[model samples]
Target: MKTYTYRHPEAIEHTGEVPVMDEQGQVILYSQRVYENYLKRTFDKMFDFRYFLKYEVLDSQREMLFTVKKISRRGKLWFEAVEVASKKKYIISYENWRIGLPTLFITDRKLKIQLEKEFEDWSNFLLDEVEIAKWKAEFSEELGEFHMTLQIHENSPIQQPEFFVGICQATLFVGA
Candidate 1:
């Protein structure tokens, strides 16, 4: 398995670049939260509300790999991630009414990826009833730092792991 870590400085407003590092602490990717409208972004930040935002994951060369956009349906929230090269779309939704740990479902045309929270800060990504990856998050309020780590199995079937990382970042940013 390969491990990747994402680290960023914690902030009240979630808008910045988060760097993803490999096991050797080499920067592998960067996830960036971008807001187009300054007024709207400021307003949302001031009110602690975020409805529309875009997140982009880029390679070390600064080439876009995938883009995630927050979308609303009725009163619930959803996220859509599109692979820039293939235009493949992944839809992620939250199960808000669950009794225990929050769950998220990431679906595409061919696969349905389920992230089942096993503990307060750990989750397992399952594909076809098999554990493909593990996710763990750590937060340090005192130091104002946040970290997300992913352990991906060598045999994992997911083609675009960056998309999953981007979705995870989006979930954290939106506090979902």
Candidate 2:
């Protein structure tokens, strides 16, 4: 087998955004795209909160789903109505209620699992058993594909360099 090296004469330089052609010779991908800045200001306002939040929507009538939810509970409660949409959906139409407990289990052991299970059990409660199964299947797929950037801002903050930038790429292709 012949080994290829990038700088050697044996290797071909990769031009950015190589065009992929179908059988009909139609261009499938190009370096250029018509980027519409429409609603960017509106979108920016949505993210105007001090805390960072974003989500990549996998599917819907909306091209990309974006929402900022402020969690509120009526009073001290085990469970609160965070969201209930379409009369049968757990979509984030409301805020997730939570106790003022640290996410990290520094002083509490059951807090993490309890919080997770809260959402899990709540999911079942929101939908019928059959609908829950189907919604979970689709939502799980979306969950796997859904990638978001989040940074927990610290009130007592310190400057830190980004560690992942210019590091590497790991390919994960499990399909034929």
The candidate maximizing lDDT is: 1
Tens-digit per-residue lDDT, 1-176, candidate 1: 88899876676356666788888998889888877788878776776646666788999887999999888777777889898999988998878623656577889878888887643567888888888898877887787887688888877887455876887777765553
TM-score of the candidate numbered 1? 0.88
Deviation in angstroms for 48 in model 2? 16
Question: Model 1, poorest ten-residue lDDT window?
Answer: 94-103
For each candidate, how many residue pairs have backbone atoms clashing (under 3 Å)?
0, 0
Give candidate 1's error at residue 35 in angstroms. 0.8
State the TM-score for model 2.
Answer: 0.19
Best model number under TM-score: 1
lDDT of 2: 0.18
